[model samples]
Target: MSRTLIITNDFPPRSGGIESFVHELARRRPEGSVVVYCSSPAGSDDAADPHFDLRQPFPVVRDAARVLLPSPRVAARARSIAALEDCDSVLYGAAAPLGLLAGGLRGRVRRQVALTHGHETGWSALPGASTALRRIGDTTDTVTYLGRYTRRLLSRALSPAAAVRMRRLAPGVDVERFRPGAGGGEIRARHGLGGRPVVVCVSRLVPRKGQDTLIRAWPRVLADVPDAALLVVGDGPYGPRLRSAAAGMESVVFTGPVPRAELPAHHDAGDVFAMPCRTRRGGLDVEGLGMVYLEASATGLPVVAGDSGGAPDAVLEGETGRVVDGSRPGPVARALIGLLRDPDRAAQMGARGREWVARTWSWEHTAERLDGLLGAPGRADA
Candidate 1:
C-alpha cells in the first residue's frame, strides 16, 4: 500500500461543499494510508478541537494560518510532510494557489493531482490568477473538474498538456443515508405540515442561491396552490434579509441550520427540492455542480435547479426535474406549481431521479474514479 499526502485548505470543522468533499474523499482512503496538511479555521487556535485530529483514521497536521497560500513556507512544510510520510502521491484538495506547490514538490512525490471547483472557473478569467493556473497545470500530473461548464472555462487557462489531462471527479451522494422514508414523517408532523404540499430549498441563505427569489415567488405559488408551503433550510449571512423578504407569509418557514443527520429527513419532507442559484459578480461566483441537488435526488425528490455554472449538470432536465433562470421568480414559481399540482408526475420524476442517483451518483462510482486518478489499488470493500 502506498502512502498519500492530502494538501488542502478545505477540511472538516470548516463547513462548505468543498470542505465536505475533501473530507469524504480523504476518510475513504485506506486506514493509515493518508496524512492531511490543512490550515486552521478562521478565528480559531490550535485548541479549536483537540480531538478532531485524534478521531481521524490518519494523521492531520494543522497550520496556524486560517488560509494556506502557496508561499515558500507552505511549500517547504508540504515537502517536509511528504518526505517524512514517504508519500508516493500528493492530492491537492483545490487546484488554485495551492496547486502551485506542485512545482516545489515534483521530486518529492511520484504523482500529483489537483482538483478544481466552481471558483477555479472564475480564477481562470483573472489576470494574475490565470497565470498561476497555467503554472499549476504545467506542473501537476492531473487536474480534475466538476463538470463540463467548469471544464470549458478552466481549459482556456491551462496549458495544452494539462488541458488534455483534465478529468471529471464530481461529488457523490450516500444513497443509504438519503433515501425515501428517512424519518420524513416525524419531521412533517413536528412542523405541523401534515400532508401539505411542501417544496424544500436546502443551501446557504445567500443571494446567489436564490432563496430570496423563492421568497419573492411565494405569493404566486400561494395564488396557484394556497395550501403549498416553502421550506428554506440552512443558515448564512443572508438569513436576515431572507427573513424580512418572507415576512407576513406563514407559508414560508426557515429551519435555520439543521444538523447534518437531519438533512435527509428534511429532503424527504418535501415533494420537490429547489435552489434557483444564479451566477454573480460577472461569473466570479458560481455553483460547482450543486451536490445538494444530487442528495435531494437520491432521497427520491425531483429537483428544480438554477442554470448557473454546473448546477444544471446535477439535474436531468425534464426527466428528473426542471432548470430555470434563478434570477426570474416567475419561472421558478411555475416550476414549483407544476410539480405541486400533479402528484403523479412529481412522483414519477422523483422515481427517475432516485434511479439516476443510484446508477450514476453513488459514492462507489466516485471512489472508483478517484482511485484511478491516484493510481490507488482497489479495496475489496470499497
Candidate 2:
C-alpha cells in the first residue's frame, strides 16, 4: 500500500473552499493509506477524527507571524506524520505557510507535490518571504493547479520544468449528495420561503465574495421580481458589514454559517445561484475556481456569477448560467432577472448543467484521476 500525507492550512471545523476540498479528498481516498496534517485553529482539540486514518494538528500563527517565521512547529509535525505512516508522497493543498513546511521537508521524503486551489502564484506576500517560498515551490518535483488560470499564473512564477509539471486538476463535487432532486421543496418550506423564487449565494462573507455588490443588485432584482428572495449562506468577518449593508431588505435572509451537512438543502431551495465575486481592493483576493458554482450546477440550478477567475470555465455563457462583468451591477441584475422571468429556460439550463456535472466533475472521477497520479512510479514520496 502506498501511503500519502496531505498537508493543508485549512481543514474541518474551519469551513472554506480549500477546507472542504481537503476533507472530501481524504474521505474519498482509497482504502488504508492516507493521513492529513493541518494547522488547527486556536483552542481547538488536536485529536484525530476516527474517519481519517491520521490527523495531526499544528499550532497556527497569524499572517504576520506566519510570514516572519515560515518554518514553525508545523514542519516538525508534518515530518513526524510522514515518518510514522511511511508515506510515499506529500501533497500540499495550497502554497501557504503550511506548504513551506512541506516543501522544506522535501529531502526527508521520496516525492513531493503541491496543489494550487487558486491564486498561489499571483498572490503577493511580504517581499522577501514571498520570493523565498516561491523559489522553494518552483523547485518541488510536481505541482497541480485547480484551474487553467492558476496554471498560467504558476507557469509565469515558477521555472520551466516546475511549470511543465503543473497540471490542471479541478476539484470534484459529490453528485449524490448535491443532486438536482434532493431537497428542494423541503428546504424552502423549512426556511419559510414557500413558493417564493429563491436566489442563493453560498460563500464566505468577504469583500472578494462581493456580498455588498449582490446586496446592491438585490434592490434592482426586487424591482423586477417582487416576491424573489435572496438567501446568503456561510459567514466570516464581514458578517456584520453584510448585514448592515443589507438592512431594510425584508426579502434578504442571512443564514449564518450553515454546516456542510445542511448545505445541500440550501442549494436545492434556490431557483438561481448568484456569486458576484470581484477582485478585492489592492488585488489581494480572487476566486480560484469557485467550487460552489459547480455544486450549484450539480443541484440543477442555473448560476449568475462575475466573469472573473475560473467562473467562466464552469458557468457556460447563455447555457448553464450567465457570466457578467464584475464592475457593473446592471449585467448581474439582468441575468438574475432573465432567469426569474423564464422558469422554463432556467430549468432547461439547470438540466443541462446537471448532465455536465455528472459526466465531468463528479468526485468519483476526481478520485480515479488522483489514484492514477498517486500510483504512478516516481510521482509520490516513496
Query: What lDDT does the true structure give each of the candidates?
Result: 0.90, 0.74
Where does the lowest 10-residue lDDT sum fall in candidate 1?
A: 373-382
Candidate 1's C-alpha runs over 4 A off are: 43-50, 376-382
lDDT per residue (tens digit) for residues 1-382 in model 2: 7878877666665557777777677777766666766554434323424323234232222221212234656577667777887887877776654556655687777767667766664453346545644675665666677766666665665666665666556689888988877777887877788999999998888877777788888899999999999999888899999999989988998988776788888899899999988765444466777888888999999998886676677777788998887767788889899999999999999988888888989888877766765655334211
Task: In angstroms, give how far residue 363 of model 1 lies from its true place.
Answer: 1.1
Error of 2 at 292 (Å): 0.8
Model 1 agreement with the true structure over 1-382: per-residue lDDT tens digits: 7988999999977778998899989888888789999998765423555567789899999999889999999999999999898899999999987999999999888889999999999999899999999999999988889988988999999999888888888878999999999988888887888889999998988888999989988999999999998989899999999999889999898989887789999999999999999999999999989999999998999899999999999999999999999999999999999999998999999999999999998888888788888894322221
Clashing pairs in 2: 88-381, 88-382, 89-381, 110-381, 111-381
TM for candidate 1 is 0.96
- State the displacement of the C-alpha of residue 300, model 1, in Å, after optimal TM-score superposition: 0.5
lDDT of 2 at 14: 55
Winning model by lDDT: 1
